[model samples]
Target: MRIIFLGTSAGRPTKARNVTSIALKLPDPANGFWLIDCGEGTQHRLLSSKLKLNRLERILITHLHGDHIYGLPGLLTSRSYFDGAGPLQIYGPIGIRAYLEGVFEHSGVHLEYELDFIEIDSTGIIAQDDGFIVEAAPLEHRMPSYGYRITELPQPGHLDLTKLAELKVPPGPLYGRLKRGEDVKLAGGVIIRSSDVVGPSVPGRIVTILGDTKPCGNAVILAQGADLLVHEATFGAGMEEKAEAYGHSTVLQAAEIAAKAGVRQLLLTHFSSRFDDEAVEKLTADAQTIFPDTVAARDYLEIHVPRMGSNASSV
Candidate 1:
């Protein structure tokens, strides 16, 4: 899986940053992506990449703020233009269905694909499909907002071809059995044990994304041992007063959260427009003081979640 940032600026777009939108690409899945927070110009960002928007199955909205979802109607219309297929499931806090409906109604926009919206109020698992599960928690925003956690289930252990070849077993159901940790009995009392062929199952990966929120109770739990954490640092350490007043976290606060949660990698995004090019480095430096694996998020940044036994690194 990979995370591609479309817009990372907070409040408004600046010379170096846009707004808030991210695409989580699961190339192996039938529905390839979980598109989160379609800020303005998100379609333009999509057009710049080779990612197929038609493969998008889930759209997660953190809040109803314009900076978070102004690009929805445009993206949905653009999907129709591209002949997108399948229902688009969207999850938000509340009033999101009406909000989108009102926007489409006022704008006279129509679509050919189904659009599903789930507006929730409490913390719980929101969606589960294949081997992935997504959970939502309320965030401390000016408006009713939410943060999402995505967990990738571990895959079956790799098959041992050499062992099978030694056993003179041809390619067939025996390989499947070994991969699933099942011992297979061959003809003439020849038994092959799964322990002798299959390797250990890999650990699952977790990604936690917090939108426009302050450090709160659920944030740490949601981020515990996460592979990658995308949190908003709207203000730098210099503006802690403003950050607290607005229910937003500063750079240091974000780092503190990552350290406490024991996340492998920390990505600081949703930066205030006041600090653009210089802000990335300055805030990144401040965050590094707390956690060594901290990084400032930039527009169009591509982050890869490491494979089994691979080390995690910031993009």
Candidate 2:
């Protein structure tokens, strides 16, 4: 899986960054991508990105804030232009459905495809499929907000060719049955156990993407042991008081959460527009003091999250 940052600025857009849109591209292009947060100008940002509107499968909103959802209506409307645009699923806070319906109603805009909204009232498992399970938890923000934890399902282990060969098993339907964890009885009446031949199942990856929030217990719970943790860092180290007052987190606080969660990597985003390139670097440096795996996310930055137990880095 890969994460593409469409906009990384906080509150409003800057020359170098937009607000807070992110794309989580699946390994298969055909499966399309899932969007997290749709800040204003998000569709415009996608024009420059490799992601396609028709391939967008689901959208997960972190909050109802203007910076997080202002672009949603435009994006939904624009998606109709793409050929083969299938049904879309949107998950967000309770007011999200009303918000979208209100916009479409007032604007007199109709969509070509089906739009399904899953309004979240409580926190738990929000979505589950054959490939992934997504859970949501409340976050500490100015208003109602949430964080998502996406866990990929475990994959089947490889079949042990050597062990099969030693057992005199030929490559045929018997191999398939053995791989499926079924006991296979040979023509000679010898039974072979799948566990004795197949390797262990491979664990899937975990990714946690949080909304604009102050460092909170739920954030740690959502991010615990995640392969990648995406957190907001709207201020530098010295602005803790202001950050708390505004319902935001500083870079240091973000790093501390990542550390406590024991995540493999920390991605710091939703930066305040006040911080220029030099200031961002300084904040990142300070964060690294607490969590060495912390990375400051910028607009258009792409991070490839490798599978669990892989030697690959998430840069």
Candidate 3:
């Protein structure tokens, strides 16, 4: 999986960054991509990106804040023009459906595809399927906000080619059957069990993306053991007071959460525009003091989340 940051600024767009939009692109085209938080000008950002808007299959809104959702109506409208004819699922806090309906109705806009909205007012598993599961938890923000924990379901292990070859198993359709954990009987009446020729299943990746929030217990719980933790750092290290007043987190606080959660990678976004390159560098350095594997994200930055071995924890 890959993560593309389209906007990384806090509150509003700046010359260097835009506000709060990130795309989680899965390897499979059928699964498409999932968007988190679409701020104003998000469609323009997508236009500039190498990614195709038509491949966006789901959108997860963090809150109703303008910096997080102002671009939803325009993005949905533009997607229709780009042949995005597939059903799109959207998950967000309560009032999201009403907000979108009001906007679309007032603007007299129509969509070409189906839209499914799942309004989350409490913490629990929001989505679960054969391939993955998504859970949400309330966050400490000025308004109702949430953090999402996306856990990829564990997959069956690879077929043991060496074992099959040693067994004189001819390479054919039977190989596929054995790979799928089915017993196959050869023409000679020899039965081969899949488990005997397949390795153990490998664990899946865990990713946690949080909305604008202060350092809280839920944030730590949601991020625990995550391969990648995407959190907002709307202020520098010494600006905790200002961060608290604004219902945001400082770089240090973000790093602290990642450290406490035992996360492997920490990607910090939603930066304040006031921080120049040098200031941003200082902020990142400060975060590294608490969590070494910390990255202060920039717009258009691409991150490929790593996959671990079977020993890694899975949901």
TM-score of each: 0.94, 0.93, 0.95
Where does the lowest 10-residue lDDT sum fall in candidate 2? 306-315
Off by over 4 Å in 2: 165-178, 183-192, 312-315
lDDT of 2 by residue, 1-315 (tens): 899999999999999999999999987634689999999999999999889999999999999999999999999999999999999999999999999999999999999999999999788999998789999999999999999999988866899898899999889998888877888998899999999998888898999999999999999999999999999999999998999999999999999999999999999999988899899999999999999988889999999999876754544
lDDT of 3: 0.90
- Candidates, ranked, lDDT: 2, 3, 1
Cα-based lDDT at residue 9, candidate 2: 96
Count of clashing residue pairs in every prediction: 0, 0, 0
**What is the clash count of model 1?**
0
lDDT of 3 by residue, 129-198 (tens): 7777999999999999999999998767898898889988999998888877899988889999999998
Clash list (residue pairs), candidate 3: none
Query: Which regions in candidate 3 have their CA more than 4 angstroms from the true location?
Result: 29-31, 309-315
Per-residue C-alpha lDDT of model 1 across residues 75-140, encoded as one tens digit per residue:
888787666467889899788899889999998988888899899899999998777899999988
Global fold similarity of model 3 (TM-score): 0.95
Query: Which of the two candidates, 2 or 3, achieves a greater TM-score against the reference?
Result: 3
lDDT of 1 at 232: 93
